[model samples]
Target: MNTPDVAGATGYIDTNFKGKAEKAIQELNDGCDFVYIHFEAPDECGHRRETQNKIRSIELIDELVLPVVIEGLEKFVDYKIMILPDHPTPIKTATHASDAVPYVIYHKNAEIVSGIDSIDEESAKSTNNYVNFGPDIMKKFLGA
Candidate 1:
């Protein structure tokens, strides 16, 4: 898929990306055990140097994806869901910073972890902050 220019040069956010996200979520609901989706619309908006687009993307996730995806998973009564970004690209720099992105994961049997506010401390101990430690974290979650 061609990435749309989020700047005024394009003037409009393409709707296909979100539509595809919806479809994929639906398909996963049919049979897949897990689904991992990444849409860079927010990152693209940031690259365009606007938080407004990022905010809009966030709202779309809240309004569209969350309800559909979560409701689908909840139906199984044994599924888990995790949502987070790998890293955030700053609007001003339009570049990915080596900063940690907030991450979260859940399993039907896993207790909800609370009060672990920031990834900063965990990231500081690692080589790349903001770089994903998702696989490692996932392994642990599955093992539990």
Candidate 2:
């Protein structure tokens, strides 16, 4: 197995989603078959119980990062994207929860008719497709 190279910003609020997205795009342009981009602001906000900031952080990711990455992915003939949080950090408890988190696996050329209008905790649960083990999700994402 090939060891993945991990690179990103390190500070709490300084974890720049846009920069990370750009790096991911660059990796793709440089012939990388897979790139993982992680945004930590929302998790940090959840841990600090900053509910509004958490929401805003998620919004920033949607606005400043995902679109850029999606556009970058368009340059490729085939690509798969898997978006998910490692775990849930509820603002009420200001700590990590063992509850399952939502995930989205999108294939570029496949026609999916799942009828799921959105990707979120509730929506993922509504699909009734749960992977009990974490690594299993990676296998599923890679079509292994």
Every candidate's lDDT: 0.61, 0.84
Candidate 2: clashing pairs of residues: none
Off by over 4 Å in 2: 1-11
Per-residue accuracy of model 2 over 20-88 as CA lDDT, tens digit each: 888888888987778877678889999999999899888888898899999999998888999999899
Model 1 lDDT per residue over 18-120, tens place: 4545665666666655556666677788788878887787677667667776666666757666667666788889877776566555677666655555444
Q: What's the true lDDT of residue 80 in model 1? A: 64
Shift in Å, residue 46, candidate 2: 0.9
Candidate 1 achieves a global lDDT of 0.61
TM-score of each: 0.68, 0.90
Worst 10 residues of 2 by lDDT: 1-10
After superposition on all CA atoms, what RMSD does each candidate show versus the true structure? 6.3, 2.6
